[model samples]
Target: MKILSDTIKNIALEIRTGKTPPTSNHEYFGEEINWYTPSDLDKGKFLGKSRRGITGKAISDKKAIVFKPNTVLIGAIGDIGKLGVTSDFSSSNQQITGIYPDPKKVDSQFLYYWLKAHKQSLLDKSKSAIVPILNNKDLGQVKILFPEYISDQLLIANLLSKAENLIAQRNDSIRLLDEFLKSTFLEVFGDPEKNPKNLPFTTLEKLCSVIVDCPHSTPVKSKEATNYPCIRTSELTNGYISWDSMQYLDEDEYKKRTQRLIPEAGDIVYGREGTYGEAIRIPKTHKFSLGQRTMLFRPDYKKTNSIFLWAMVRSEFVYRQAKKKNSGSTVGHVNVKDIKQFRIYNPPIELQTQFAQIVEKTEVLKTQYQQSLQELENLYGSLSQRAFRGELIKY
Candidate 1:
């Protein structure tokens, strides 16, 4: 596998950083232009309409730099390797670097894929491990490996793009399954917010047998793998506890943390601070303790089903309440006092169980989709490595 390499600066016709207009100036922001942040890079290879935008006044006042369509954007701050390609004329904040590929040297899509393939290598050049920062100079000097011929570059780019599209399709399938589950919930129980079925309205305190807040202090963290995992706010993502980023606690610490009550399979866990309102039913797979800024709910069997209670907590009905009740202005967090007063639309136990059964069946399908998605992602990673090394296609 033969490959030609050059620094990004030599291949790029122009390199520029994005800038943000003064936020206090109300005249600067409108829906006129895409104002991208590091977060927007997650939308895929090509940038979509940004969540926010700036007015023409911002561009005229020299408060923001507008990049032409097809410019490649890369995260330059904490999230060092995040990437996006502009789909239209756009401006971004200071945390992104825009590169205009020199047509004679490399194809735009090829450069984008090449950067994706060597993301880890770029990450390695970050100045600090604690708070990763890649300055313009380091980023400019970053090495790019590609086939010398433009035709080979296009072939490699197209191959990787097709592979990426497959991965995206699997993800879309999983998301559709999630939507179906939500629709089923609505059909069976009606909206928790409106309670169109005229179900009994009650407070969260009466709905559960016990509601326990997590230990206020951080537990002693173990560096090695252990049977005891201390679930943190970050672990609660997209309606589930992701153990991949979990912190392990020593046996003694785990026991100490669980002194109030042990977490069980059916118990529901909610993040009260940072990513508040996201809740997940504790699965039967492992014995774990809750970390700070989280709370636990044990549904009374006589009153409701665990999954039903979890579904209500995860609903937009509760999310809106959580946001309004946030006590901290800087770091949003919901208080236990406010949480206990949350109004819930309680349907009969029988109807709740029926919804739970539907959820269980839907989850099985989602698991299959997720497994397929993981395999596709792994395949893409492998193909990317080979494609960049000039082994994917026989030239």
Candidate 2:
């Protein structure tokens, strides 16, 4: 193990800040140069391209400095400890610091991985201020356990790279499945915005039997298992209730919290605040209480299919309405009144049922892909821990 200061050749900070920002359409104005910021860096990977580019005029005017390829970048402001390696000639905004490794002393890929592994530790050292910051000096003080030989470093990097690739592949499969579902929805119902099929339009209130709000106040949570699970906005994801991170509520608390309504298998739960408009259909009959900042909708089965309603609310048309109705300085929210007023395009019941069947089939495949992805992620975590602790070499 060696202090980073001793092993690295140089640490360079990006000089451009608020004073000299490239024009928004720099490509049309001047010579194009790739410019990166904290947002441009993907966690634990190299940035081959950047979304925004700065003009060469900025460089010629002494406003920016371009770092050569293989330079390791670390975010010093906003999103701290985001790491990325650069390809070809590139420059970053003032918020990132570039680390150039000494070829004779350390391999660039090895440094990248080491920094990725210790990102949290680096963030921990950040000064507590209005905005968290990790300066060049703090970055230089980081301590890493480096192998004596470059070959050893390459071996560790290669193993971790393979793990990342597998995880990425699994994620790609999941994304493709989601895209398929979206395409199918468009093909069946047409765009909800345009109503190109001239489907009957109705207010969301008319299609549902009941719309109940979550308890205004937060309920007391318990770590121990209870008869009821409390569903919060955070637990709503991918149009389903995630019980993996749910909190518990005892009988008495559950009864009081759910006095307004108890969700049934076909009901839809909508997030009203923060992550607004995330709607999930209740998959089965379950004893659960709603946490704050959420709404429960029980669709009239004869009028609409539960899954179809879920898809409609989750669609861009409804999302835009939710966003427009949302208010609040710190935390935006859509009240029950606005939610009830949301307009929904109603297709035939038979078509809605068919769409539900298609969704169910797609979800089954998605679940399998998600499970595989989680397993790969776990494997990557295990390998990373072992590789850093000098345990992988023995095996």
Candidate 3:
């Protein structure tokens, strides 16, 4: 790839802290400006939509500068190297820096992706005293390679845009499939809202082994590696958990930390709160252990199939029940007490096995669907690298 040395910076303004913001809306005292956070960005680069929005009035007296719709927003802290571009007019908090690229000298789209591709490089220099942050000086100095002329830049952007559309279509398909899976669950079990069962419900603790969430006191952080599976809420895509996005854990750390709850093959792990009610069966590869804020369920083989238990937990009725019992001022969470009382339907073991078979079948198909989508994503990535290298054949 040819190297172009020109650089870009965010609108040069003095840094302002949140409490001493340059602007503020008196109505919402705690609201930040309609700014996007680092956590809002996805690896896929399509920032679907964000629920958090701040306004000019909210940032009163703070650095209330606004970013133009065309500029790309970069994460400068905790979540390193997340890239977001505006679809509508917006501004961001101090955690994010709005990049006003020199579009005349560089393709903003290309520069955005190039920064995305080299996110780690940006992150490496994002070290700060109290928090990890990308400094303005480094961001402006970062060089981007470009084609000899604007036409080449346009050509590259068009190709990437094509791949983006394909990826987006596949994303939509995946979402559609997820809806189908929810429908399937309803088809299998009667709808929770309308069809509240008169059938007897049993306490989860009585039906199976209930492991409480890990201690939140202090967690041993995994040092990231090239390839080892780590599970967090972010990896759960749609209704199913995608293991591919996980952080790699060293064997020693994995074994040491999760030793007490190195889960069994059929164990069902539950994400206890926030985006709660997701339960994933332990695939043989990751039958390792539990993380903080996660609950592990080991079904009694004679009474239930693990898959049946998974469906049972995720059903609308269960989520409603979980929601009702949640506590906390800021974020509601399901604790061991709440989980112990979670009701389970004591249907015949035969029916449990049957449902397990169906879930397994769905999983098999889902795996294939996920693999195809993943392959397309990989292909797009490979094409991006090749296109940058000038190795991709011009069509």
Candidate 4:
């Protein structure tokens, strides 16, 4: 094993920090190359697609620098420690530093996993400023221990790659289930935006018995387990609450806070600020209090199904509405008024119930996929920890 500084070759740092020439400058989409940034890197995976592209002119003018395939890209600014490997000739913005590993001394994938394993340490090296930034010089000094033989590095890379692939496949299964539900929604309800089904359009306030946001102030948190879990916007994910991450409040405090709008099993919780437009249904009755920047909506069972309402609010139609109504300079948020006023296509109660039933069935499959994904993630973490520590070879 040796320090990463000794195993790596040249570390190329890009300094160009302007927007690539727009689509107007390119003859066609083919003339543009994939331009990656810190956002494009999905932690350990290299997302080859780019939201923005660099035109041929930008590349020709030296406004963007292209790195060859297998070059490990690390985020140098804003988002620190994001890692990825270029699959093809790709250019990154100024915020990234590319590391080209020595083929004889180290494998690229091994280097990637090493960096990922030490992501937090690299992040800590960043200057504590308004926005943390990592310099190439500082990153170059970071230490990584690896085997002397490239074969060892290859072996470790292969093991970690297999773990990553399993995690990805599990994620794909979950995504496909979500897609199936969305496709079914569209097939049955028609596009909410187009209203092809000619369903009656009405404001959310019309379909629900209650539409109210939580108190705008933070509740006093308690360390004791006797307290009720407080559901915050950050805990909302995949149309459900992340119970493990919820904060806690004293029983009395929780009772006082939620006295006006306590969340029930049939109610839908909507995140209003920071991470707006995400809605999750309370799957079961629980002693919980609503945190700030979130609202509660209890659908009238006769008018709408809880699952249908959840899907509707989580749909693209509602997302567009929320985006349009969002107001804030730094962090956008939708007001309770905006949420109440947002239109939804009201279909027959029986039809909405049918969608809910389908969702219930798909949720069972999603739960299985989620459990497997979590297990794979845990296994990957364990393998990663052991592999870098030189303990994986024993297995």
lDDT of each prediction vs. the true structure? 0.88, 0.79, 0.66, 0.80
- Sort by TM-score, best first: what order? 1, 2, 4, 3
| 125-149: candidate 3 lDDT, tens digit per residue | 7766677867777776665566656
Score every model by TM-score: 0.90, 0.87, 0.73, 0.84
Better of 1 and 2 by TM-score: 1
TM-score of 4: 0.84
Which ranges of candidate 2 are over 4 A from the true structure? 1-31, 223-227, 242-250, 327-331
Task: Give the Å shift of residue 306 in candidate 2.
Answer: 1.3
Residue 239 CA error for candidate 2 (Å)?
2.1
Alpha-carbon deviation at 173 in model 3, angstroms? 3.1
lDDT (tens digit, per residue) of candidate 4 on 1-395: 43244513243333222234345645423436888877888645665677667666677776667777788888878888788887888787778878877677677788888888889878877888888888766777676688777888888999999899999889889889988998999999999878888999898999999987898789888886644778889989877888677788988898889878777787888999999989888866467778988889999887888999999999999999999998966997998888998899889999998898999999998889989898999999999998888876753
lDDT of 2 by residue, 106-152 (tens): 67787888778778877877888889987766666666677666777
Best by TM-score: 1
In model 1, the runs with Cα more than 4 Å from the true position are: 21-35, 51-66, 129-132
Best by lDDT: 1
Quote the lDDT for 158 in model 3: 76
